[model samples]
Target: MTTLRIGIIGVGGIAQTRHIPAFLELRDQCTIMALSDVNIERARETAEKYRIPHVFENYHDLFSKVDAVCICTPNKFHAEISIAALEAGVHVLCEKPMALNVAEGEAMLSASIKADKVLAIGYHYRFMKEAQAAKKAMQDIGTPLVTRVQALRRRKVPGWGVFTNKDLQGGGSLIDYGCHLLDLALWLTGNQKPISITGSTYNRLSKTPNQINIWGEYDHDTFDVDDHVTAYIKFENGASMLFETSWAANIKDDQEHVSISGTNGGLSVFPFELYTAKNGMLLNSEAAWLPGNEDFGLSQAQNFVDACLGNAELIVQPHEALQVSQIIEAIYENDKS
Candidate 1:
């Protein structure tokens, strides 16, 4: 196996929790070369922990040494670092949500196209076996008419770090937590054209001065982002989707399911169940299957390297991920009304 030299930017929570560990898992096929973070101390700490040789306080300084880079920054820096990496002729595997807006996504995609390098967004859940099985099972539904996504956590607002700040992290739970399900919904639907979106957001709980927060206690009065979001989307192909996501939603069950309904049958993931309106019985049968526990981050990193080496196809192309950004931007735009 050829070794792909990899570097990591942003030694934040995500980089520590997911990217570093995931890249470590691919030691046989890849070399961990560099680590970069705005906080030089944190960057050096991460490099020390991961045993990576090179460390840089600035991301631009690492471009010449690595074959590819994993961008693990906030929503705003995704496009900037990605474009920079691509322009310097390095492949990039950027974390989700891809960017703060569609135009930024376009610029990143354009750079990837112009540079002729691989640019795969970190929509890793799509690489899960359960999700891949759901895509295959989608045919059983036969042309989905309605799709629904719910990634709601009852009163479990992430009240730590930048979670409560809208400026650092464009939107709240919907953009952070719900984006996973949103991307899953679109990927399963084969990236259909969305015509319009109607959305609404609320901050009933966060408005209070003090409140119960799971991640940690914080100033609820200063929480300026939306804690709840609901959206209805219309597709050009006549399909309709309803998305509901929140960090502190007043609902039973911390729900995380993306369901697709069709004339012949229906499918519900998370529980990994499929119901078909067939066989003389009114009740639908269960889908017999095992859950997909694949290391999506590892798979994602491997795919980027594979695509760069011309050994495999791009899992989630730039244009496909761009559509997701478009839908997300539309929802945020309409929800402002």
Candidate 2:
């Protein structure tokens, strides 16, 4: 068994909280060999805490020391770091909204293909136990007709890090939070190519003078990103989607829902339920229990390591991630029109 040497770029909260822990848990298969960040002090501290061998201020300098790299940088750097890693002959597992837009995503994809390396997007929602069950159950629902997605949060705009920075993170809510559910919906529907999209984005709440918020506080006047977004998409395969997401909305509570109405039956993710007409009677079925590891982050890390070792296929392929980026870009563009 060849244990992969894994490097982590950007020693930020995501790296500390999710990627590092997940990769560490899979220590038998992969080792966190090196880490890098523009903040060299944080990188050194994280390296010391994790007992990782090497730390570098430059990501390019750390690449040669590892077989793969997990990019946890802001949206603005995803494509740049990913391309550099891939071109260095290292597999890449980049944090999601693969890039700021489709063009960058395509370039990242090209780099991966050119280097013949694995390019896995960090859409870890698909690795959840319920999501895995839903993928298998999708066959029972027949061809998908419509998908409804709502990733709503009640006054919980992240008040930490570069989340509110439009230049570093691009759009908010839709790009930061909504992209996860959107990726899952598209994946379950066989990655249907979206043909048309119309969308609206709102930042009025964040831009208000004073607001009630659960996730700390931000400078209202300086807020320049969408806090809410809604869209309608038509796929080439005749499947349509109604998508709504928000970081701060007047909703009852935070909601993360994805449901698909198919030609034969229907299914909903989140709680994992199935609906159908069986034997001339209406039927609804829910899982009494489900299988698979519940920790999506660990499962996602394992999958990436296995793919790097050629023992498994990537769950979130580069092109599928690019499709998600396409829709996100379209939605932001539609907001302008």
TM-score per candidate, chains pooled: 0.95, 0.98
How big is the positional error of residue 121 in model 2, measured in Å on the Cα after superposition?
0.5
lDDT of 1 at 103: 96
lDDT string, candidate 1, 171-198, tens digits: 8877788888999999898889888899
> Compared to the true structure, candidate 2 yields what TM-score?
0.98
Question: Candidate 2 local accuracy as lDDT?
Answer: 0.94
* C-alpha lDDT values of all predictions: 0.85, 0.94
| Candidate 2 worst ten-residue window by lDDT | 287-296
Clashing pairs in 1: none
Clashes of each: 0, 0
| Candidate 2 clash pair list | none
